[model samples]
Target: MNKNFNVIAASMIAYFAYRELPSDRLCRSAGIDKGSMFEDATMISEEKIRNLWVNAVKLSNDLLFGLHFGESLQLSALGIVGELIKTSRDVGTAITAAANLISTITPLFRMEMCSDEIHFVIKLLPTERYDHNDPVCGQIRDFLTAFTIHELDGLTLKKIRPVSVIYPADKSNVPEYERVLRCKPSIGDHVGITFEIQDWDMPIITSNYELQQLLLQSNATVKDRMSSEVSFKNKVTNYMLSNAYLGLPSIEQLSSNFNISSRTLQRKLSVENSNFQQITDNVLKRLAISYLKEGSHTLKEIAYMLGYNDPSAFSRAFKKWTGFPPATYQRNEEH
Candidate 1:
């Protein structure tokens, strides 16, 4: 919500990778001013922020960079910060503690960790729209790679593997993947980040406990304020069920249907834990799947339903969403 948050969030990644990529090249490609990225605190447009993400990905060849950046920053910094907060604890409590502390610094992402006796699942939720070019995403990948190594180094985790984003056996990036994960990397059908939970009972070694408690308390208070944003998010999701395919509606039109000011709608949705873009994607994914299954509509038809004008563009998006071509999805569904 802060004006300069995107630039700062994206730029810190440039800072992190500055040695590998010179400052001038990264800044020019990312469309950021060298000095202002760190100094300017003004809120930037979503367009500019998204462009930063796009540029970062194109320049770096990292698809999941923004998301990786988001998750890793919290994991590392907050893990350290949480250490100053409390004593030994379970993975769930430690993660919660770290999450609470990290939310204070940046509301761009949140994490949920849970288990059902088999393994621990950590869900990373982005609070804002993701940019394909965001250097932060790459930072995130580096962070995960680094954190996997750190946990292994700490002797808390013996092996680190990703259930998703598997590296190809014959690919050139295999060495990089192996070095980062510190284990044999397997690429599977899963699409997001997952770290193994071998020692759910590992002990944390940190000296500060009181600071952790205070950070948790503060997080609790902020969460209460943001709860309404969740409802607004759901409502927005419901609104776009059949509408997003028509075109992205104005906030005013959407708010009018709900009988409130667009400002009030946004405020409440912020509390409910959603936003327009997120809702739009939710609806689009659903609609795209549905249209694909019907077998009557062409790719162009599906794209138009999702508010795109061309079939080629739709095909590209479909591939991105499902990791398969539209024709492949249809053929498989038919079989």
Candidate 2:
């Protein structure tokens, strides 16, 4: 539906911590407008959110930026979603609430939960594919895992350490993982956090059934409002945003998903004064800018993600879009 993230999680601490680094400059470097963050109900591009993490790490020179940022996060930072989790009767219910409300809180990723007799595993999958070697992605994963543990402990009033925190082998912050997680972290194929099964049933100290019911109603209202406001164009763009990682979809493919003929889809888009090609170009432009700004991936890597068969072709496309080669654009942004 808009492929956005609530700015509260990124901007709250950023406002105070980044005094020397103006938010406007950061937003521009990330290819987002500064005014987006100042709205009453601020919602920023998911790409901007990722770029923020990358830039924060670059500016702070902190390998543990995500872990450190998450360590200080309070329930208030998450708004109603945090409230819903805090008021749940048990840790299991809290986890469920977090899972259910994640799309409303942040549509950047999806949370998948699996449990065994001895352990419960929660895996974080990005709504789009990212470079596995990008440390910013790993750091954000670390932040989310650590933040979940921290929130659960706060609600249950116990120091509940996960059995293990697993991150991609390519992440550079190896030593800091153990320090931040307070457990031996494993380098693995999956990005997930595993906790002992016993903690799942732990009763929350702040559980309030009445308050939770009220929050649930409030959450549904928010979701409904969001759904009502999303136009068909946005729905198509959102789908493209998530699936662009695999490859950009053709008009025929997109129309098929909507159960419409290609001509019908074209007509609908024309009525909105837009077209599939324009939307695809916009998505590619945004991603190209974000990747260029992040500066971690090579031109080839970014090219592949944008569905280019060759780096030279992608470079030409990027130059046309932004009036500068990708490398030059990145260097200028750095300056």
| Root mean square deviation (Cα) for candidate 1 | 21.8
- Model 2 spans with C-alpha error above 4 angstroms: 1-4, 9-28, 31-38, 105-108, 126-128, 133-136, 169-172, 207-335
> 1-335, model 2: which lDDT tens digit per residue?
23225544343234213222344455556666544444656556566677777776666555666665565343224454556544678888888878866566454467889999999998877776555666766676666766776666546645678888777643565655675576767887766889899898988755323222322332222222123245556656655553343246788656643445789887878888999999889878876776666566678767875778799999998899989999899889999
What stretches of model 1 exceed 4 Å from their correct place?
2-17, 38-40, 44-46, 59-90, 97-112, 116-118, 123-174, 191-198, 208-335
In candidate 1, what are the lDDT values of residues 1-335, reduced to their tens digit? Answer: 54434434443343224212343555566565544543446455545554555665665555444433432232223334435334445544565665564454344556556665656655545556434354554444344344433332222212335444343232455554554454555654222345556545555423123322322332222112212233335435533441232444567656543435788777766776776656666666666776667666668756764667787887887787788888899999999
Clashes of 2: 0
TM values, all candidates: 0.39, 0.53
For TM-score, the strongest prediction is 2
Task: Report the C-alpha displacement of residue 9, candidate 2, in angstroms.
Answer: 5.3
Give the Cα lDDT of each candidate: 0.48, 0.62
328 Cα displacement, candidate 2 (Å): 68
